[model samples]
Target: MRVMEAALVMMSGEAVVVEAPSVAAGFEALYEAEYAAMVRLARGLVDTTEQAEEIVQDAYTKVFDRWNSLKEPGGYLRTAVVNGSRSELRKREVRRRIGLDRPLDSGPDERDHMVDALAKLSPNRKTALVLRFYADLPEKEIAELMGVRPGTVKSTISRALAELRKEIDR
Candidate 1:
């Protein structure tokens, strides 16, 4: 475990050194350890690497802002990234409707066949598949993150796997 120097503060005109380890160090370690995986997870939702990295960074910023209050930082960060990606998709949809967005890039070498197929799924199904398979999260956890019941997650995962198999078999 890494420990960073605590800070000193003046309380009632008295100087006191805080004993707690630095949140900045903790967050930095977490960022270093998880950034790549989080980016990949975000990519599963957002498609483009640049968009995925942006989503992850945005999510990390949000998570860092609320770090002290978060009971489960990992879960909180994952939910934030997922929510951020969903928000990005909504914005992209709006841009597409307004004809402000470019056509989605598509080329054999530029895309992962499996990931591309996953991206073609409905949003909820894609989230279910990514959380369950890519993140290795349990069904209950996925349900909570997606705001659905456990049964819904089960069915969603089942259907998503079946769909993926069909795509891969083609």
Candidate 2:
């Protein structure tokens, strides 16, 4: 029994040391692998690419800290990136309300005007639009994410597009 206890202690020590070495390396690999995708995802949420990159970096750091708890680290990273981007966007909106008008680069495509118009929508509508159009997610998936029925997603998208069309025509 004494020998078995000593072996367990030795194994635990070795496990800690082994995990220590891999943690940093694992984070670096995850950072490199997901950096661009996260940034792109963020940019679609917020205005500037630089802000998107910063948010993605922040999300990756959070992911690193909770790496072991994540069953799918990639999904966790994506959620973090999305949350960070939304936070930044909300901050920018507050700043705008206070008269801090930063110059925004309107996206190069004409369709972006539609998206920009969509940004004026309520948060739920905007999220539904971005998920449905930008992410190309099906209405069913978006409904699940937004905790609404699929019909709600469809109606929201339809209403959002109608509003966009009015804005564009005017």
Candidate 3:
């Protein structure tokens, strides 16, 4: 009976000692695996690579905090990075609207203008565009992430592209 009790204790102790991966370790793996791709994705959504880097880092921090709850961590992180870049762009637009800041550049080919045009769009449209173009996600994936129908994603992308065309023509 004593030997049986000792065996149970040893088994339970070993079970308790088996640890899951740490959040930091998970985040590091995610960062290493996706950082460059995220930066490139963000660069298309933001004005500069520096801003893109900052946005990606902010997204990673958020992912770190919510790692355990994430089902598809990579997809979540990508969406978070896109959302973070969009948020930064929105802040810049607000500043521009309030006369708190000047347009960063006037170059026609510069991404700043493209980002500015995107900022003028509705959040849903902007999100759709980012997910479809920058993230290279399919319409179904964009709809899934945006919590909308695939038809809505299609319409949003159409409108966003029209807006971009008008901006480019200016």
Candidate 4:
């Protein structure tokens, strides 16, 4: 059984075979492989599971919209998720500043010190830490995703780790 059809064309005298995966088929495979991981990535960067799911869904919609044009769909999807998470955090901050945000009353059983410390971090620091630790991304890749220099990513991660240590110590 052929998964994709190969076409042969003659450039000079020798024939060249070219095979292309169907857009829908490729996208389905990508979604199946990356959906869970993408959601996890988003969850690390966002406040709630619901927001993570929404961010991932929106990223998938964006990836599917430009699937054929993307050179690297996975990278595009990652960038989209990071951007979406950043936007969500900014909106949340705006609401908090405007007194439109409500506080969560977590029981002692649900309160996680590390999570609380992470939430207290600035968005850039939080993003740098999440991408470095949770995603296990290299400084270069994290820099690319965060649109910063590798040196900046290095310093950000260092400072974030120090801050996390201080926060958790308290």
Q: Rank the candidates by lDDT, best first.
A: 4, 1, 3, 2
TM-score of 2: 0.70
Write out the backbone clash pairs for model 4. none
Error of 4 at 59 (Å): 0.4
Candidate 4 residues 1-170, lDDT tens each?
23233234325566654445586578778888999999999989887788899999999989977877999999999999999998888787778779998654456886888988988787889999999888999999999999999999999999999999999998
Instruction: Encode model 2's per-residue lDDT on 1-170: one tens digit a residue.
Output: 23224335756537533344455566667877878977887777777788888998898778866877878787778768767866776776788788996646575663466666766765566667787788888998777666689999999989987877787787
Clashing pairs in 2: none
Error of 4 at 12 (Å): 47
Off by over 4 Å in 3: 1-25, 106-127
Pick out the ten consecutive residues of candidate 2 with the lowest summed lDDT. Answer: 1-10
After superposition, which runs of candidate 4 have C-alpha atoms over 4 Å from their true positions? 1-21, 103-109
lDDT values for all models: 0.80, 0.73, 0.75, 0.85
Clashing pairs in 3: none
Cα lDDT of model 3 by residue, 110-169, tens digit: 546567777567556777787787678999988877677999889889988998788767
Quote each prediction's TM-score. 0.74, 0.70, 0.71, 0.82
Order of all candidates by TM-score, from best down to worst? 4, 1, 3, 2
Candidate 4 TM-score over all chains jointly:
0.82
| Candidate closest to the true structure, highest lDDT | 4
Candidate 1 global TM-score:
0.74
Per-model root-mean-square deviation over C-alphas: 5.2, 8.3, 9.5, 8.5
